[model samples]
Target: MSLDEVRDEARAFLSDHFPKWRKENNARGDLDFEQQRSWQRYLYEHGWGVPTWPIAYGGRGLGMLESMVWNAEKVSAGAHTFFNLVGLGLAGPTIIARGSDDQKARYLPALARGDEVWCQLFSEPSAGSDLGNITTRAERIDGGWVVNGQKVWSSGAAESDRGMLVARYDTSLPKQQGLVYLLADMHAPGVDVRPLRQIDGGAHFSEVFFTDVQIADDDLVGGPGDGWSVAMTTLTNERMSLGGGFGTFAMSFDEVVDIARRTGRIDRYGLVDIYARRTILDVLNNRVQSKLFAGQIPEAEGSVIKLLMAELGTLTADVAIDALGAGGMLAAEAPSAQQRFLGSHAMHIGGGTDEIQRNAIAERVLGLPREPRPDKEVPFKDQLRS
Candidate 1:
């Protein structure tokens, strides 16, 4: 369908369904768990959920442009998208790109329909940006694999049904080559999830522990030793999603302008600086989106955009906080200027650190020589011993 047609249809559907759902749940704020599931199911049944996914996977098989139109309409109608963000944005896309047919059949349908929530079990205490340094081990077992290790900084792990995990499977190989990616059941016998309280007092991030947790061979996402490549796909999608403004508390330029006006700081030079940066951010985001629409993966571009986004978020929040004077110290609810300032800190840390992104941009985009690593050719087991 044409963009106009897609927009009209999306607006009409949201108009008819969203208000009813809101009224029924009396949801003046965010939806509860059950309400989120119900809303997802409602959208899936009507062919709006995961609209960019293939029809066999519970979507309308729409293109990126159409999906953007649908989402724009949702924003206009004050309707939220699917609550299972990791499932739809990160895990689902990775599985489609590298998973076996059986894996796709088993996981994608429920994920797209929001019957299951998913999380990424990639980061660990010792390895956040350096993912290949993770020490989570997966050993070959009788009927499957037995996992024993810990994952930290997993968002929504406490509520996830499954997780996309990367573990060390062959210590004799190089660190990046010895890994395996798998789908882990969060409800498995030895799996534990502990929510980590944030500065905002929200437990959106969690620590996941796997102690002799058994995963069937069928849950393997790709061939053994292909974990690094599979993980790259997931991480690339993650960076793109975050850079696209999926999981951020970023304020628009207009919102910043309004805050400045409200606090009598409209004439501040910071406003001009923020306006210039916001314009640059919009251009970068548009370039990334255009690449995606053209069926290209913007790996280095993703890093650049993510880096810019993090900087922009922090700058915007800082300006707002300064504008608010002492009022910023008095905490309001979330998305308030004060809360946003605090939350913006996470943007620099999540997806990938700003330093990591800068390194990626330097190496991948600017064609710079990589930083020398003594462990580059070392075996994983030897590196661990060192």
Candidate 2:
């Protein structure tokens, strides 16, 4: 379908089905877990969920433009797309791009259908931005590998049935090379998950501990020693998804401008400047989306979007706090803006740290001199830090 036609259909769908949830619970137009699951079921049944994937993978096989249109309309109507986020955006894409045929058949349908929720087990207490430094170990045993380690900041772990995890399989090799990727059942005997309470009183972030967790051989993804590259694929999808489809969500640059206008900050606080920057940011966003529509994997461009969005989010929250003044105390009416001000730090920490993203942008995008790693040749076991 043409872009205009797709937009029209999406608008119609939003008008017909989107729920106008309360601001306190529906920031970014997001739904609660149960609400998100039901909404995803409808989208999945109608071939709207995971629309970018092919029909065989339980998607509508829509073009990128159409998918963007659909997302924008949904967000505008306060529709939530939360339930299948990790499954659909991170795990499903990685599996589609890197999983074997059997693996694809096993995971994609359930993920797209929202029958199962998934989380990522990539970060550890010691390896947040420097993921290659993780110490989670998975040793080969009689039938499979025995994993023992702790993973931190895992989103949706409490409810996830499975997770895409990376573990060190061969410490003899370099840390990056010795890794293995596996799909782990969250309910397995040795798996322990504990949610970390956030400043906002939300417990979505979890820390997962594996005590001799046994992963069957069939759960392995990609070839032996291919985990790092496979992980890069997932990370790429993650970085892209983190930024968004544009002009969507309950809070955005547009909302920032709206708030500024409403509070009369537009006259004094350079709201026009924010609007101008948002215009340019939109152009940059569109450029990335155009490349994506052509089937190009946005490598450095993903980091650019991530960094921009991080800055934009902070700017909006800061402006909100400033503009709201006494009104900031009214959490019910301005929940999104108020909460945004309180939790602005997460944007920089989640996905990847802001500093790390800047380094990526500097070296990767601008072609600057790569930072020297003295430990590049060190074996995982021989490395001073475990």
Candidate 3:
């Protein structure tokens, strides 16, 4: 179908369906968990939930442009996409790229239909930026693997049904080697999730602990020792998703202008600066999407987008808070300038830290030399001992 047709269909569907669902569910602002699930199921039944995915996987098999149009129309209609973004943005793509046919058949339909939610179990207390330093271990056992470790800052983990987990399977090998990627059952016997409350008073992030958690051998996403490569794909997509302006704290140039005008800070915060930054972000996103549609990975470009997005989010929040002046100190029941300012800090830390993105850009994009690592060849066990 043409892009315009897709947009029209999306607008009509939302106009017809969303209000009824909202009214029936009594959803005023942000949706509750059950409301999000019901809404996603409603979209999926109508073939609009994941239109970019293949038809066999429960989508309409639409191309990138059509998917973008549908998303724009949904936003214009004041509808939210599926709340399980990790499932849609990270896990689903990684599975499509690296999963076996059986894996895809078993997982994709439920994921696309929003019957199951997924989360990332990559970072740990010690491995936030330097992911290669993770101490999580997945020991080989009869009929499956046994995991014993903890993951921190896992978004939506408390609500997830599954998680993409990277763990050390053979610690005798180097830090980046002898690892394995597995699909973990979040409701397994030994798995525990503890939500971490943020400064914005939201418990959107969590700490996930595993103690002798059993994962079937069939849950492996790739061959043994391929964890690093497989995880790189997920991380790259994560950077792109975060940088594509899907963030909770994203503010458009028009919104900033309106806020400035309302607060009489139109002259204090330069509208020109906000407009320029927003334009740059849009151009960067377009370039990245074009490259992706052309079947290119654009890994380095993802880093650039992530870095710029982090900076822009912080800058926008700063402007909003400054414009609000003393009024920012007062808390509102809904998300306000103060909440956005507090939440913007998470963008810098999640999807890899700003410093990590800068280093990646410097080395991979600019052809600069990599930083020295004396322990590059050290075994994982030995590194832990030190």
Candidate 4:
């Protein structure tokens, strides 16, 4: 089928399913587990869930433009691709790029179908953006490796089936050269997941502890000492996945304008400025998406999108509240507005922090002086920790 036909069919299906399903669940947040699973199964059956993957792996083998159209149709219908964001977007693509045939055959279909969920175990107490600084150790043994470590800020770890893990396999080498990436079974013995309470009253972020947990040799993604390269694939794509929606600002902008217009506060809310800024960002985001569709990941584009989105979301929320006017303070959208404001705070932290992204844009994208890394050449055993 042509891309437009595929989108039209998807639109018809989503129109039939979404509105009633959303009303039944009353979920302003993410859909519940069963609701998500049923929808995912429907999409899988229709070959729409993992559109970018090969047909052999339960995808539609769609081209980039088709994939874009499919996502647009779903979003326009308010149908989310819930339950498989991490699996399909991050883990699945990374596996396709780096995993072995056995690994791909074993894991890809399950992940695509949402039978197994995955989390990332890259960050630790001492490592967030500086992932090379992680202290997680994996000791080589007879059949596999035994791991012992604590990973913090793991999203969805509490409910995950597996995780993509990076641990030090040769502490004798330099920090970045000693790492290995592995697929860890979250349900394996000696694995512990504890959720951390956040200011938003959600415990989605978790602490994962692996005490003598064993991972098979076959679980490795790239060869030993290749973790950094393998990991960069996931990280780079993560930035795109998180911020690609900035191109769709018009929908959100229209919603905000409608609320203000109904409340009769459009002039008082300084919406003109909001409109101008949002339109510029929307155009920039479109260009970024076009580059993405053409297979050129333009330098600094993701960082630019992420930074602007964080700034724009916060600004939009504040303006929306003001636009609601005094009597509208107690309006139905007030709580949702407050929730969105609080949620936008996380956009600055997740994927990569604003400070980290700005530094990346400065050093890597722009022709700026790179920051000095005293430990870049130091052996892992001798490297000083700040």
Candidate 5:
């Protein structure tokens, strides 16, 4: 079958099966681990999952166009793609690009099959936007290295079995030069995870502490002092994944049109706002969509899509509230409009804050001057922090 045919088939299968598959409890809290494993196994058996990965890496050896179509169909079907979201979305691509042969053999299959859950361990208490300024120290030890420090705002770390961590190793080297990326054991004796409840009331992210955590040589993803470059690989993948079709939920502006027509709000001032939204939507479907087909290499512009989606999310939730008036918040037992309101805030904050993304686009994509940072050259130990 052609790629379109394959996508239609997947959509039809999902349309018939998704509702029954998504039991109420399954949607209550990020699909349970058992359900995730089962769902991944189903995808694996069906020649899906890891579509763009090499055949040798346990992927379907499918081309990017086919993979993109599959992702669009999957989202349209409302199929839960949360299983190994971070693992496959960010970590897997990084490993494929920069990891050693052994690393690929050990991690890629597990990541593809959902056997291993991965979290990003890049942000720190004092190093959110300025991640290169992280104070998490990894001292060289006899056999390998010993890590000591903390990482915060890590998504899914509480349930993650492993993490892709970036840390500073040698004080003598330049700040960006002495950094390294490694696979950290989440269950190691020195690793501690504490959930951070957000304004939305979900404990989806966590702060992780590593004290005297010993990492063997094999655990290091790239060579010592190459963390920045290795991190760029992951960062680029993260942006690509963000801009990738699957990353954007299929909640299009057409739905807003439907809601406005239903509520007779199409003639109001709010309708102008909706029109602006439709304009943004058109740019996405026309400009960005065509750019992808033209084979333009991706960049932090992926974050532009993410930022647009976040804005749309907020607008959508607000429109729902204004349309339903007093009744919007009443559906407590079912999936209510309030849930969307609660959830939209995270879209801007998670996956690198909107501010950080703008900075990246300005510096990397537009060739704007780099942001001033006096601490860029300072050693982790020498830097003073509150």
Candidate 6:
């Protein structure tokens, strides 16, 4: 089918099976796990879930443009905004780029069908901003490897089947050189998952503890020392995934505009400035998102896109508060209005903190001198963490 036809078909499918599934409303705040599975199965059957993924590994094999169209259509149709964000957007791409053939065959189909969820095993108590300083260790065992460490802020692990884990494999080597990336079995004997209740009163993110957990040799993504490069693939996918537009939610710019007009605030001097800023950001965000979908931007530019999104999100939320006044903070509203602000607040904390993203922009994108690090050369085991 042509790209346009494919997009229309996908939208029609969502309409029939999930008419209320708007982009922003798709998350549904952890309700109805069965329905989530049912919807995912419906998309998989229609070949719409992972459209641009390779066909050999249970994907639709569509082109990049088709995938972009599919994404845009999902948002336009108000399908679920956060459906399969981590699995399809981040972990799926990373595995395809660096995972072994066996890994692909074993995991891709399940992930596409939303049967086996995956979470990132990056980030730790001390390694949040300085990812290279991770102290998680994986010792070569008799047949595979034994992992013992802690990883926090792991999104979607509470229900995830597997985790893409990074650990220190060779302390004799340099910090970055000794790294190794592996697909950790979340249900392994020594693996423990603790759900963290966030300020939003949700448990989407979790802390994973691995104590002498074993991973088979085949679970490794790349060579032992290639973990750093392999990790870049995952982070690149994270930025791309985050920088894209959300189409699944029902409320959109058009709806927002309509509301402004109805409330007699479209041209109100104060509201006009708010709408103008949002309007400008909406346009710029779309353009950049298109570039990302087309693969026009380099991996390093991921930080730039992330920074723009963070700033835009902050501005948009401020505008909403100004326009809605007290009602914006209310927990109840028309079917969709209440959740709109809930989603906007999450934009700042998800993916990475705005401050961390700015550091990435400064050091990676602009080629500015990196911030000073006194422990850049320290051994992973020696770093003090309270």
Per-model TM-score on C-alpha atoms: 0.94, 0.90, 0.93, 0.89, 0.85, 0.82
Compared with the true structure, model 1 gives a TM-score of 0.94
Kindly report which residue pairs in candidate 2 clash with one another: none
TM-score of 5: 0.85
Candidate 1 regions with alpha-carbon error over 4 angstroms: 245-248, 332-335, 384-386
In model 6, where is the ten-residue run with the lowest total lDDT? 245-254
Error of 3 at 197 (Å): 1.8
Tens digits of per-residue lDDT, candidate 6, 1-386, equal: 78779777877777776655434346455436656766676678777778768888778887656666777777665555465668888778988988888988888888888888788999999888668878899999987899999999998899888888999998866577789999988999999999998754578789999999999999998889899899988887777666455522224445555555555545356445545655654565567656756768655455555555555555444544445545656655332444444555666656677787777777777889987876557665555655
lDDT score of residue 144 within candidate 3: 82
Winning model by lDDT: 1
The total number of steric clashes, by the backbone 3 Å criterion, in model 4 comes to 0
Q: Total clashing residue pairs per candidate? A: 0, 0, 0, 0, 0, 15
Which 10 successive residues of model 5 have the least lDDT summed? 247-256
Candidate 3 regions exceeding 4 Å error are 23-26, 243-248, 333-335, 384-386
Worst 10 residues of 2 by lDDT: 20-29
| Higher-ranked by lDDT: 1 or 3 | 1
Model 1, 1-386: lDDT tens per residue? 99899988888889999998789877768778888888888788888878878887887888766776777688778786548889999999899889999999999989977899999999999888788898999999876799999999999999999999999989999889999999999999999999999986689999999999999999998899999999999987777666553423477677778877787866568878877877787777777778888888788888877777788888888888887777778776225677678788898999888899889889988999999988868998888532
Model 2 score (lDDT): 0.81
Q: All candidates' lDDT scores?
A: 0.84, 0.81, 0.82, 0.80, 0.76, 0.72
Report how far residue 224 has shifted in candidate 3, in Å: 1.6
Per-residue lDDT, model 2, residue 70, is 81
Pick by TM-score: which candidate is best? 1
Off by over 4 Å in 5: 1-33, 247-295, 327-335, 364-367, 378-384
Candidate 3 worst ten-residue window by lDDT: 240-249
